[model samples]
Target: MSEPNRFLALFDQVVDQTIAFAELVDRAGYAAVPVDTPALFLGTRVDKIAIGALVRHLLLAEAHWFEQVRDVSPGGVIPFPSNAAALEGIPDGAPLLETYRRSYAERRSQLEALTEADLTKEIVFAGRRYTVIGFLWTVLGHHSFHLGQIDLLMRQQGIEPPEYMEWPEDQRVLG
Candidate 1:
């Protein structure tokens, strides 16, 4: 496979795996937790936000970065919320995960269509310029970091998280 295609496939796999993991969380009943339940925050107790708000934060961040890459200004992204009222519009449980998945599928079609040249096209955000590929790499890494946080959230709540994904032999892209 070509390098750009491989990167796109990896991105899709990451999204798919996240959706699967979230399904596990939903089935385990954590996703139904009250909006006011504390999120697993920085190894400190004082700065914690609601667990549902953490999910919303991840969704909004993904949408914002993807929109920036598409040269579209993000509108209506609520700032990370500290309380339940701030999370008013976002859904909980399966509905929230479905929204996360659908937003990516809709917004990322343009990204998935990019040629290698397009991947190298520059965009500026947060006062720094970077290629589309750079932004994608950032998104993948950011999702991974938050995935671990979700895992910890599960563990802290006395639920064993879903098993980690094993790369399938046929899908292996790296030697």
Candidate 2:
């Protein structure tokens, strides 16, 4: 396959992984994670961002990138919440999930339009300029990184995360 097609395929794979992991997280009930400051796992020094805040950040990032793909400033249809401070004014559970679904659809459409030539497009992210491909890889990396955090937090809270489920033809049941 051509390089662009390869990356596109990889991006689709990551999106599928995101969907699977997100389903598992929802099934494990992310709503159960406490929003309070003193409620982290016993003596754990790494609860810098509350669980609710983390979820908000994830939602915000997904929407932001979706808009960015269109060369548009992020926010018109939805108000952009503060990346870290969204925890203070937590968004509702079902609404946030709906927003996430919409953003995922937007992202898929944007990515579907990607071309090899577009890979050379430059964008600034985290104070550095990167090609579109690099920026997308970074986005996938960021999301996956937090997925790990959410899984760990779930375990610490006595919730077991679901095993990774790769797509296959025979598996007909949804988890």
Candidate 3:
């Protein structure tokens, strides 16, 4: 495969892993980890936020970053509620997963139109500059970090999160 095709394939892998993991969590039932259930997030500061809030934050952050990279002015602020009371509007389970799917479909379509040269173009955001590919890598890494957090939340409730690290045969690019 060409370099551009190879790079784009990684995005597909990330999306597949995210959707697969979310499906596992959904099948386990949102009741398994109640929206208001406090879960510890090991960030710079230890936060015990509601699991639903964290899930909502992840979905919004992913979509926001994707939109930023696509040069689309976002419509509203990204939600990152500090407490359950602030997250009353956030939906969990299949509805949240469906929202992610829709966002990914839109972002993926934008990505498909970019050439390899476009990936190297620099863009400024929040007073910092980053190449298109660099921003994309950051987005994928953010997904990885949050996926682990979600997995921990699932395990805490005796729910088995989807296996993300496994190299599925279908994704293998055979020579």
Candidate 4:
């Protein structure tokens, strides 16, 4: 019921939803599509990178966001490299899954160590200061936004998203 515990609970819910979304994406099956094709976005398609790459970027970005919150370096950015020959640097299939797993582990560990007092403290990143609680909420929102996009993409590909996935349950009590 304390502030920090509440924040941690919210964080856990967000991560659970993210994992569900990822599982849905995995079940949808990645098909060979041209990298230049439009990606699914809220029932519409927009010119963007392939779905696989987008998923990879989402996973990497989530990890990076967590790293920033924990005041650690996330190493190199994982966006698509411009050089066609550089694709080899990104492991395909299973290795990509491994990277995500490792990042999740680190994030969870950091989350476990957070205290309520920590939530109110301001942290500076890239010259911008944000309360720990605010940063955590931002990461959650980012993941939810991307998951919405993934759902649309799956529908476009004629794949049905998992039926069990739903919006994160609201825990607030109404007076």
Candidate 5:
């Protein structure tokens, strides 16, 4: 396979891992836990922001990275409750899942359009330059890093994280 195809395949794998992690969080239930500080996990505090807000933030952040590298603007932030009181208005169930699905689709589409040359080309953002491939890897790494935090929060709440479904033995890339 060509280099771009390989990168795209890896990107898809990362997205799958992210979705799996999100599923764990969703299944763990969204209960209003006591908040001693502003940030709960990874500096994302539960003060004025609803848990849904954090979920949306993560989804939007991923989308933003993809859109930026693709040279397109995915306008507008997804509206979510800003506080515990607002949780009543935020649907804890299907709506959030739908939003995540849509965001994933957008990311996948943006990734599909990338060529090998596109991946290697340097893109400037926030006064810094990164190869498109570097940015994509960063996106994946960022998600993986936060997913661990979310998993930890779930465990702290006495919720077990979902079992990581097994890929084929031959397909296991990590030792």
Candidate 6:
């Protein structure tokens, strides 16, 4: 495939993964969230950042990076909340889930509209230069990490998390 085609294909893969994760979380049910999962802020531990904050955190992180790509400074993401206390002020569950869905959709639209040249251009972030692809890779990894945390939290609450997305052929549907 040509360069443009290659980038589109890769971008599509990221979209697929994001959608899969969102579906898994939706099916898991937020009402069953763990009251307390291991959480920390900075070096000193505190009674902040609960399981309820995880989804919002992941969604906001996606928005933060997307804003940075628009030439906004990392610190320019005003109202970007980093802790559970701040998130607690926001409505969660269905309200937040809808917001989360919109966030990811907007990010995907932004990426899909990028030209191959744009993807290859360098973006300086935190004194380091990275291609558009490099920045997205970081976002993808960060989101995946948080997804794992959510899964662990669910297990701690004795709620079986949704299984990983797999080939329909690999999974028996009517077993």
Number of backbone-clashing residue pairs for each candidate, in the order shown:
0, 0, 0, 0, 3, 0
Residue lDDT tens for model 3, 1-175: 7545665577667666666766666544543434443444444223444345446666666666666566632232322223324335546767766776777788778877876666777776555567777767776687677767667777777778667666343756822
The number of the candidate with the highest lDDT is 3
The estimated TM-scores of all candidates read 0.69, 0.63, 0.68, 0.61, 0.66, 0.63
Q: What lDDT does candidate 1 reach at residue 157?
A: 66
Model 4 whole-model lDDT (C-alpha atoms) = 0.55
Off by over 4 Å in 3: 2-4, 26-51, 72-90, 167-175
Which residue window of length 10 is worst by lDDT in model 2? 72-81
Model 2 residue runs over 4 Å out of place are 1-48, 72-92, 165-175
The RMSD of every model to the true structure, in order and in angstroms, is: 6.0, 7.1, 5.8, 6.9, 6.1, 6.8
lDDT tens per residue, model 5, 148-170: 65566566666576654342123
lDDT of 2 by residue, 107-138 (tens): 77787687656666666665667777676677
* Residue 106 lDDT (model 5): 78
Shift in Å, residue 152, candidate 3: 1.1
List, residue by residue over 19-90, the lDDT tens digit for candidate 1.
Answer: 666566644454433334444343221234433444666676777666556653222222322333433565
Of 2 and 4, which scores higher on lDDT?
2
| Candidate 6 local lDDT, 89-140, one digit each (tens) | 5564556666666776787677667666666667765566677666666666
Q: Give the TM-score comparing model 5 with the true structure, all chains together.
A: 0.66
User: Which order, best to worst by lDDT?
Assistant: 3, 1, 5, 2, 4, 6
Q: How much is 147 displaced in model 2, in angstroms?
A: 0.4
